[model samples]
Target: MSKGKDSPAKDGKRKSKFSDAADSPKKSKKASTSANAAASSSTSKAGSGQATLSVKGSGSSFKQLSKSGAAFASFADYNPAPSTKFSIYRADGLPDETGASTNDTDERLLLAGETDTMAYVGNNFEFGSSSEARGYTGHYMVGVYDPSSSSVTLRAVPTFQVARSIKANSSLSSISSKRTFADYGEMTAARRALGDAFGNRKQKANARNQDRMKVDTANMEVILDDFTGGIQDNLASLPSLDEVLASSTSSRPMPPANLDAKHPAEAYRISDLIPSEIFKSLPIQKLIDNVSDPEALKELLPYSKDFPAWIWSRLVDNLQRSSHLSGGSGGKKHTTFDEDEDEAASVTNAEDVMMMPALGATEDKEDAKTKVRIAYYMSLLWYIQSRPKSVSQRGKLITALKLDGEDANKRIVKAILGTFTETPANSDRAVMSAFHQTKVLAYMCALALHLDNFSVDHDKLARNCNIPPATLRELFRTLGCTASVVGGEKRMVLKTPFTLPQPRKGKAGGRK
Candidate 1:
């Protein structure tokens, strides 16, 4: 052995300097081409996910064009995009040149994907049942031709089976005597007489001899001419890939179908944009009830913009308290005591009550921060409508409510109420219907929560959440609340068996 012989490591794992030098140019060229392709795709705005096809000296082929031109001509490309359009025409099979097809017997056929623009010309011939006396069955040949190419493509393989027997459902005499097609006028000049065969007769023959393709499948030959012809046909008939894709997607929001002019998503978005504080202190449910009429709601909802999320929240709080004070559901009523009971609230109220409240300021500054709590509650509502994930995004929620602009909340509510009352026709009516009950429920929940009345029916509480009545009742039962019929009707009322506040760490804790 020579000392200069290659070592084991060099042979298996290492590239020699000579080899590396030889490969450098190839690697460099590959990298350059890839980078250029990427750059071209980006600058030309080509459809995403489309494969780039290129050819050298291909001349006028899409591949030879610049990226922009390629993209523009994508429809004419032979390859099918995900977004292609096609129309299906029903026919039993190819008709005779005389333009007649018979459907007396059920026929088997294959369904396959095809280019939208290509057309195949097929001819028909007739086959006889026997070497001697049977009528002629039709024969059809489907062939493809391309104007751009000189070659012809013969399509349709004959390996398939033919029905062993075709029952003569029509009168044998009628079939023999018929001069014109049953359905079309061109089927005249009888090729063969079926005559009066009482039953089906088995005739052994191949698919082509029987004038039909056999069971299961058919293969078509696609020649160069056919392929080119197909490409040209597709270019003229099919929409561009971009158009196809755009047509497939919907532009409108998919909220509850019956959303009002202020869509639920839009309303929820607006609520999200507001601060949570506005909803905290106000008796929102009572506010809703007091402004139950559309006109009043319209008047008050826009003013809501002047205050922050906390103020709106406060309104909800106030509304809830008012509902409790007024006695929800119009049952037995009791007079206000204002005695040793409510001592804490009374003392707090006495200290905090003021002749007038300023923006973002309450007589009791700490209580005024109730706005933060208001913002918190509205955020939850927003989540239920806009973000169904059941997680909170405090910043996003607050911002959404604020972005609704001044009085947007009130404006939306007013519009909702108006829609409910008017119940416009068509899509408008649908939108109004969705808001009608939901808005009412929102106010009801605001009232119940603010009053801290766990005794209030949980089912009813959920009803205030603006869900379908049945759904609200189920939720109430799930939460261990009892359902009651109200007003001697099918309408249901939700009530808790009793009120108890589950003690929690927070100071805001109250009756469940």
Candidate 2:
């Protein structure tokens, strides 16, 4: 009996659970229908022309409308009236207090169901010519008026002010086209006076010629003064040529006893090899001659370290000055050096002199000139690479070179390569020796930094440097540098650490 009761109870529980699950979906469907109905009702109300009247933009309820144009009004519920009219009245102090009106004499008829109409209400509404008496300025009352019922329905009562005249006379008061007989007569008289002033052509021409002659005379005087002033002064101050040569050729001036004591070998060696007159004539001699200040002479130690240093510094300086005076001709105009046989022979001899023997020992003038040309180019390249302050001069040089044509850059690259490769025998050894003596390896590295973006191509750099690709790789490796293959190209990059000086800030009370 207990088991039979338990079975009926289980059946009842199953039926109850099934009924609850079915009822949940029905309830959700009814709720969704009610929500949709509410949304539809709100949409219908919005579509029924129940929009609040306001300006298109926010911030202010009262709009500043132009007196000569129509203003729009949004309606809450649009209803057409055949006799609807828009009236504008001057309301000065209070809303209830009505003063003068534009519509008192004439009303602007508005079309039924129209949102906008011409609000200007005077027959003589000439914009700029309308006066304050015509109710064009100050606070205004604007509303929809029905003529049949004699009732006004207030809309937006925007303040009206006279619009700035877009016509010519309003903005440009000084200009006017109105002309009288007197004005025309005055213009004609002025023209005639000008014509009379310039009537005599021969006299005008003579006067112009006289002025030009006077200008030329003045210019000539200026030129004469510029040309003669410095020459005359210098001539008067100059010593006799014989006396000058004697002084220059005199025995080499001795450094102070203290300097000789400190550097006996250097002093004796320098004195024996260099004549006093010749040594004194050096450009750097002036700096060295200040024996009273031995401290300043320390700057010459770097150049005096080795014989080559001393010779090369002076040689490079002379070469640079000559190049500057010649405008960097670089032996480009010498026809003798242009022949392929002569060039090949010269290159071969240069290689022997550079690689096998010491530099400055060659007695051949042609070889010397060629070396000088190469040295000049190297000096210039070094200057441009190492000196940040020379950027302007570099730009000028580049522009001048580019005047040669589109291949000017290529020509320059060839010239740079020749410096490295012109020595046919042991090109790498010769290039290394020249660069070491001149301390131009840093300049070359700086140049590589400048010519390429970040990575310099091995073949292109070798061509520009005028060395074998393998030689260049070895050179970079010797300098403790490395190369990597990127995008199927072998590239080398040298990075050196440097610090830029920070700009000094102005004092608080200082002038800018």
Candidate 3:
């Protein structure tokens, strides 16, 4: 999504270990050279003459007018080089009648010799972008360029409007206008601070009639209708089934052949994406029970929300070398809750001490503390989930003291879909270069979470993510939607529901 490069880190950002899916603000690159810098350079070259320069903005889309064959056909071909060498004075150049009352050519000032000292910088000197140049000075730089070009041309120099000194001509009078301010309908601070979500409840009578987006929002309405003779939806195009049946009495509708007798599909929940074996294998629960400070995690809940749900999955990876989770066989050992808790208590003092030697990795004592903190955070979430159910008449979730109050079994899921795992390139297990970064994967996962019924246009998402339409279509198909094009816009439509991969019941590493 960063155009094959990593986004630059933002300053003063609160980064955490639980942020494998969090998006970091990227520093935008700005052009270094500006008109002020150019002006200074030109002034130094002029040696007190103060070389005048003005940039005029021009629309490059004017080339479409060439279809009429009437614009700029008589003008000579202009050289499109970056920089050109020329003397200060030239006889054949456009006449410079600026700052003069006479229209005579002899009155124009011209300088000869020292052609090497005066190099006219062509339009492309500042990466061929006129907007950046214009931004440095609050003025447009106009000149002939290809479709999107804007530069100072030799012809425009004669008409350049240089800034002139302003002198006071009259004394000011202490007068005030009769009208003060107009009554514009603007929001008050209290009302504006409440935002659009305040008191926005919809009546049952105005319930949505459609389930999915049928077309791109910019191109057409969600429900396309026509009223040539009478108001009708797209279904009006099809002939009635009764009319077809009446046309031929002998023709009967064929019954569906359910010879195979396939069973119905099971409903999939958001929790099924990650394997349960991972939670069982990890000893985070043990850390929660044995750690002394449960309040630390309670305080960290707000910060932990900075990360997406998938970030919890990365704990397993970041703690690969932690003494708490590591075992003798390089695999986690199965133990009862009490046994793990006792073991956790024994290592409480060693949380700050590195029990294992570092094998060229940063994971050590700090990771041990991290593992405990993660458990504490998980315990806090469990505590929040275990609260008594409350029907709040006012306020919202994520508000102060607000609670979901449901059965507490929200096991976090590792990102198996739209996630990347790197391996040796030639080992035949390497994941191809795709949406591999943390922010991009999280962005895509958020999109997945927003989809309810299907049939979605991801043009805006694809453009923002820097993904090609075809590539996004394939990704959508991989994410459970059938890729399609409705009204020239790519859409993802769900027919048969997609199910995440899970092991059979009663099997090892299966969800029990």
Candidate 4:
């Protein structure tokens, strides 16, 4: 009735305007077309025969498809159906609607335009046992249920097998093996006893006992007060100071024959500054012999500075003369052959000379003698180096070698290095030998200068020098170097003079 009241044309125009205001025809058409295209694309993908289903992570042998996405299967192959259910099953052949599902649930529903993931727990089965026993082996099948078709389609089929967890042989061996637990208790008891015997508590107890014993031993019966009291009592009972002085004078030994009976100072000479005991202990002949003997020379080298100037001079002179004698006199050679003849003769003579046993033997003997002399010279050099510069005789020898001056140590080092390159002769051989023997000594001196004052392990130093420990000990004694056992090892204590200032005595008789 209302439509009739208004004009049909006007009503139609109003409806058209309202519709236009609500939405444009062109926009509506485009939106509808786009949505339809998406639905069609999804349907096309689902219907494509190229879609396949696959399973992954089966075993090491199936590693080719184990990686993620490598064995991924799309649900596109399954035709769209209402209330479609997906199920997984294990089957030997092609799975069908009759096939039993491996999954616990009957089916999984996947909604339209939506995705759902289903996780299924695998059935527990023996892995290695015989089929008759418990294990099973076969392929896994994924089935797709179609309610419209009332049938199941085998979407994916992956092979699988069951294996026994425990081996038959291992099980049987375990059953047959025997073990004893009776010793366990005894072992535990013994361990406890041992722990009690040597544990921290016992160690602490022993330490405490040792401390108590030390304290008991250290506790002296005579204190300072008691000692002073005893001394006073003894003084009261003893003779006076005058009587003691008279007794000491009467008991003294007679003066020496060389000393004046009335005045001993008049007979005293500067030479007497060195005690006669030193000469007595080390005789002149013995000193000369030691210098010549290699073994004895090693012993005397450390005490070289202690020997008198005359003794040092005699030693050097003897070594020089001996070296000269050992090495025959030096003279110019007069060759009978000219250059060409000499060359030819030398070539022919080399083989003949080698063939002559007597000549070879004589050469070897001379070489040995040369080595002995070289060793002797080395010992002499080592001795001279050990001597103090204040010793005029040692200084004279040093000057003669042209090795004197402020940098004496450096000059000596250079001379030592040169000896190795220079031809072996009287003086040169002596110098080289000395360098070889005293190389370690020189190194020690340099180290001492670096450290200023240091202590060295006696054994370690001997080993470093390639000298015997006994020889090193003798050397230490000869050099007036004191060796004392420190930290359970013998050490050479080198004290640098004037390193520390002497303490002054205060007016009150206290050290300042």
Candidate 5:
């Protein structure tokens, strides 16, 4: 007889209350004991267009009920925060069901009011297979463990097909947002595999994060140990960081020298970040000719700080003005205007780039590296903006840029974004080579979002990418733009500035 909270919403009529855990004084203490309960999982029969998710507490202290709204947040939590505290994203590449998610900025109509504790498993649920559907599900696949009891169980029926799931694509997500991890062991493994990233710097400080629970989706059930008494013993038993770092030191390559140093090229013109080849293209040349103030775009990118307003304005102007050029392959004959443009950006053949001497100087190597870093970033920006969605995913586009960052580029690029395999790699690395290009894209995207300014237009991003944005949002999060709205209308805010760790004070200095 209940309208919605206890009963399912039938038509477009009624929706349930979006509930939060309001624990009583006695239950609050009891909730802490259950926080680390060893959790297991089992999938029920999932037929076409129908599913049921049930969470039952095995603890005698807890009651058996059909819908215990208060019991939802009694367990664990995630950083990227799943749609429902009890919800399971299970897989990595699921579609963004903002309707069933806890999105404050969501503009979708859902079966029921969604929150951290509840979601809908009714008819009319839809997720598709497009480039839009493949990347960043905007959902972090994680399972919470109940620490108060011996174990808890999470069950779900499947609705969507498995999209592209790069289980090892750990670098492309938040510290807690991994591919598919159910329990504490898997969660810990996922964290270490996250390797290095700016996103990992600030972890969500919650005692729940420290709580241990078993979450294994592959198997129907996970039998976790009795971790209620003390998980600290388990944590202490784990390998030390110093031991891990020392072991990885031999495998880890040396870092680059001076990344922020001024290059001889800066004396010529700071905007020379663009590569020599194809820089003479009329469209590219327009950036300089049409600019009112050079200083607007003069900051020279790859810096996570807020960029000049003019920089993004010029970039948008160029992209919007050149929509026809989005898919154009370079063979078009140039007009007379191209000849009179910046001489430094003269169009060069592949041979020229190859023969471009590895500029000499023990005194000038840092500058050379800096110049390379800048040029690669510029080249990547131009490539992504001017290219089509198909090419963007493929490794060939990045290969064509051919601008190497020497030693530091890889490390810097990795720090910014671990990997972006727009396309599949054969035997070598994954679509990861695209990390350099993605790092450049992330920098530009975050920079456009001024600190003083809260949001940046999403449709403009779609226009710039030459395709409606989807999983690339993960790249944005990897750098600094933590949260984004689900739909394309609202602006994506840049709350945190993307920053790299300052070099330790102890390191030896280079020749001044």
Candidate 6:
């Protein structure tokens, strides 16, 4: 994003490797001279009390606006002619790296016919003087080129004057890594001690999280949600590729040009996006296994009665999709309701009570893993739909849902249905039960949606959730879910919703 003709190095320290030969000292000489001359003339007028510089536009993007519109407009038209003079010094211009040339070049040069001494200017300067003037000998300048239109302009002297005062013999001493015997040993030792202490604290936290991954499955779910959420937010907020391409039109202001092409928008295409440590940090396999069993998850969420019901509903919706139960992909399976079921049930009530959607007339006879893959694909769709329009709006909605939960669980439950993935399949008892009984469902959805790009830290995830990965794995297995892909090798697709088992297998059988 550097504005210079050449880009900077990785650490933003060295000059850009791609900088053109045009950026060399020779090319800059003419403009530098013009700038210096303009600066000198303005300074002379101001010193003689003939004119005063007026500065404005401080603390804003448009800094130093001119007093008159015409003057400001004409300022853009200001261009200098190329200089013919050459610098007395070598390529770098300065006589020695010590920077002593600034003072010695003019004042102590003891050159003939010299009355007053001058100093070497900034990064840009030209070796030239007016016909009647006498000053510095080591000065230099170069011309500025416009490659796009094949044009060139001389530097304005005013720019040179400003450059001289602000640049030139400025020392890099503060940032130099080069050390000397003059440095205090005790100060260095103290700084290192403090840094070690902070590093140890961080290591301890990492170790603790690593330990938690062994026993805590629920916490892993939460961590996954955080990671997923962060990535999605970043993705949603990033400027599109087209927007970035548009910036390449001009060279005046720099663009964020160094972005890697491989990292373009779709993060799913990259495998490295999911860190190996993420698998170790959470019980991903466990959750994928247990996504089917409604009964087990029912008991897991009872302790947190205050958990928002909508979040739970969203989770169930996601789980259903992940299990391939939301949309029918394979066989037609009939979902029959009781003969006494009411037609006038409220929409919220409709969601609370699982209905057999006419679409899923056939069931997918796939194994647990296939089911899980299907569920994951379905859940991804649901997650995107359930995400809040904006962070602030989502926060406000969550706050309202929480307050509703405290007042009436049913109120919260109704709100939960509103956030469910817009699936066509009817909800079953298992889905409703899972949402009603546990907040884990909702938390998992948030985690997946948030950290879709990154890998989970299983240990941290499990510790925070207070559930073992093994247990989650069992739950999903019971529910008929998998962690793998359900359909195409290129992408995942959710197949169908999970089927709830009645109290007992009766004479009527599963279809009856």
TM-score of every candidate relative to the true structure: 0.21, 0.15, 0.17, 0.20, 0.21, 0.17
TM-score-superior candidate, 3 or 5:
5
Residue-level lDDT of model 3, residues 1-512, one tens digit each, is 11113211111012111121111111112211243254334433432211223222223222232222111111123332335322233222433345433432221212222122232222211322222433431222122321111111211121111111112311222222332343122333344345433534352222222223334467344234333334444567766896775554223111111123221111222223223443343335433442334344334343233332222222222233344444332433222111122343343332233222212223344544443333323333322222212102112222322223322222221122112234454553433233233323332432232221245465544443344667655555444456677657666654443432232358677666
Note the residue pairs that clash in candidate 3.
55-140, 55-141, 56-140, 56-141, 56-142, 57-140, 57-141
Residue-level lDDT tens digits of model 4 in 468-510: 7786664443333466665576665533221212235578855
The sequence of per-residue lDDT tens digits that candidate 5 reaches over residues 357-391 is 12122213233233233333443554444443424
The TM-score between candidate 6 and the true structure equals: 0.17
Model 5 misses residue 495 by how many Å?
4.3
Off by over 4 Å in 4: 1-118, 121-365, 388-397, 400-413, 417-438, 441-512
Runs of candidate 1 with Cα error greater than 4 angstroms are 1-201, 204-211, 215-411, 414-431, 434-447, 450-512
User: Considering lDDT, which of the candidate structures 4 and 5 is the better prediction for this target?
Assistant: 4
Task: Write down the lDDT that model 2 would get.
Answer: 0.35
**Candidate that would win on lDDT:** 2
RMSD of 1: 31.9
Per-candidate count of clashing residue pairs (backbone under 3 Å): 64, 1, 7, 7, 14, 79
In candidate 1, what are the lDDT values of residues 1-512, reduced to their tens digit? 11124332222212111222122322345554553454344334322322222211111111222222211111232344345432222234656455645543313222123334432221111232211111322122222332222111222211121121123433677866764555343332132122112223442233224446534324344465688899999989988887775554222111112123232122122233333343433334423465335346334342332222222334443433334434223321222211122331233332333122222233342332343244334433433343332113323433444323345444433332332233344533223234433443343333333222222344333333334666544433333334454334232222323332232475566556
Model 6, runs deviating above 4 Å: 1-274, 284-295, 298-303, 308-311, 325-512
Between 2 and 4, whose lDDT is larger?
A: 2
Better of 2 and 4 by TM-score: 4
Minimum summed lDDT over a 10-residue window in model 4 is located at: 352-361
Candidate 2 regions exceeding 4 Å error are 1-379, 382-438, 495-512
Give the whole-model CA lDDT for all candidates, comma-separated: 0.32, 0.35, 0.31, 0.35, 0.33, 0.32
Every model's Cα RMSD, please? 31.9, 29.1, 37.6, 30.7, 37.4, 31.1
